[model samples]
Target: MNDLTLSSLTGRTVLVTGATSGIGYETARLLAERGATVLLHGRTDGEARAAADRMIATAGVNGERLCTYGADFALLDEVHALAARVNANHPRLDVLVNNAGTAAPERHTLTADGNEIAFQVNFLAHYLLTHLLEAALTSDPGGRVVNVSSSMHRTGAIQWNDPQRARRYSRVAAYAQSQLALTVFAADPRVTAVSVHPGVCDTAMLPLYAHEGCAPAEGAAHLVRLCDPATEIVNGAYYDRDQRVEPAPRATDERTVKRLNKLADAAVGVGS
Candidate 1:
């Protein structure tokens, strides 16, 4: 084992949603280089395939270890379909990286299922997917779930009564709330749910959202570290550069977290 390089992620299988671009792609590439069997998940087949190819190309793989699963995170039906596919194919998915995310520049955009796009894509989608794959995630004692969040989660409040941003709208706040929800969602004790702020990378997402930071690789490195078994105890926390950081006051509120859990369960029609 000592002879193996860092790219020797042998025997490990990782499923990274939103692996097409940004921190998602960088994390996939890093895992691939380490020899992990990475399953790429994206909203579209074309994008997902492209990202899988890119990871293979970038990681200098000989055969296809990185795969793709096409699922639109913004839709509950798609999330269900994805769960079925993943369960059937992946016996024990080592890591569930909820890295795929979106932010709406417009006010209160809804998905095909009529939920807020940001809420659905950034938070609800994972809620549904993870619930469906709970068995797979917890099957292994060391299984992990890493959610890519943003520092913007600090500025927003959990609008339990109006989480969908139905009556009002600010693109930034909406996005921030979604991210914040992700952070709070990590409260689950069974399957380790982790949140990360990738520290400003120059990805297309940054241009659209105008986020400030270094590069995708730099931000992704922090996320990648969470994949290590040593970091397993760092669950249920927010991180930057692999360092545990304080979440917003709202995230730390036990009552608020319990309420959000109940609300999220109701939204997903599961554990309430």
Candidate 2:
């Protein structure tokens, strides 16, 4: 494990999705405090702007250091639009925090994109966003992606032929599958990326983990650390909070990584 020292983020730009609330909000706040130009993404424009306002008010973050973007992860077109706006506005993005996610609803639901709701929001949208922002992301060295995956991914198995789980649906399985896919995505050779389980945070999704959980900021700290350029990262590495740890076996498998890229490219309408 590289002993990561958190350094000033001056002149760096970071985008954190789902920044309207919970861990995402805190992560954005911490990054902004550390001098990064934090882009706060929410499900809607108003929500994103509101998050920025709150940050400015409570965290003492300068309004000048923050920007807001809105995109509903369940909608692939919106994700593309968000990426386009970012690339046009900030050509040299330093970090992308794929933190927007949702718990699988009690019943199976599908997005307008025809994917399982959780799968689309938690994985496919991010996959598309990352690939679309390749120009900005690769504009400089040390630029990387940080996936806020989960430990629950260990229980997940990619339902290769039935990713939607249309025939046999379980909310737990659906959410885990999405997370596993995100973890596997970090291994793609096209970009520098890593995934981490940010611990059981006290947020809307707390029920999925435990009855009680730690503060959202505690979990956000782990994410902020990885976003720092000083934190040496190996592509595809998975961390549990601040400690590097092995992810599920399939997460590191080269064959699985390539296979997943194909599946995601088709799903997101990206060329292989």
Candidate 3:
């Protein structure tokens, strides 16, 4: 909410995943209103298009400033396709917001790609998408990535040997682990990136945080601030809402960051 005026984002292009609902939707709307060309992503093409249409109709966002893209993050193939489409369409993406996520189901589930459902959807998919879009993301000096991580990462520990948790599984632990890995990924040397906890907001994931929460727009304000070029940032930094703060100790460990990259690359078939 730091006076992010309309002219602040002119000529910038941002891609926000999970943009069909909650904080993601509000973030996309705010960016588009501020003159950024926003790409809205959802689980499917229909859902993404509908979100863009809704923004145009209700928020008065210019249709020309919004575009729609979709891919089911549960599948690695779809994530690759999503990245390819974005790279082909926008050669110089200014910001990539890794916001798509899902709560772990009570009954443990596994994706066809052989990863825990929450792990694949919440972390691995974005990991792959971000790596694949390297050419476009690095096309400009100002390009960067913003990971919408969570404070819950503090309670999580990576199950290095059995990341899928095939032998033992708890919904809460699974979700927390995914968020922790995402936070650690910010330290990756491949791209200039940072992670943030956008505050507990009244969104689909609110139940995981608290009984009551602030509005989605309030959470989105923090994200939009990080995306602004005027706001200086350090690679691998973590933020709590609008304040730059330390993340979980493990998240900033260089060794952990390298290990997570290796694990994620293998899990997502990055080099294969």
Clash count, one per candidate: 5, 0, 0
Tens digits of per-residue lDDT for model 3, 42-67: 99999999999999999999999999
Instruction: Between candidates 1 and 3, name the one with more favorable lDDT.
Output: 3
Per-residue lDDT for 154-242 in model 1, tens only?
Answer: 88777777887888888887888888888888866656877888877887558545657577887877877787654555568888666
Worst 10 residues of 1 by lDDT: 1-10
Estimate the lDDT of model 1.
0.79
Off by over 4 Å in 3: none
lDDT of each: 0.79, 0.93, 0.93
Q: Which model, 1 or 3, shows the larger TM-score?
A: 3
Residue lDDT tens for model 2, 1-81:
222224788999999999999999999998898889998999999999999999999889989999999999999999999
Error of 1 at 2 (Å): 15
Write down the RMSD of candidate 3 (Cα, Å).
Answer: 1.2
**Best-performing candidate as measured by TM-score:** 3
* Cα TM-score per model: 0.92, 0.97, 0.98
Cα lDDT for residue 222, candidate 1: 82
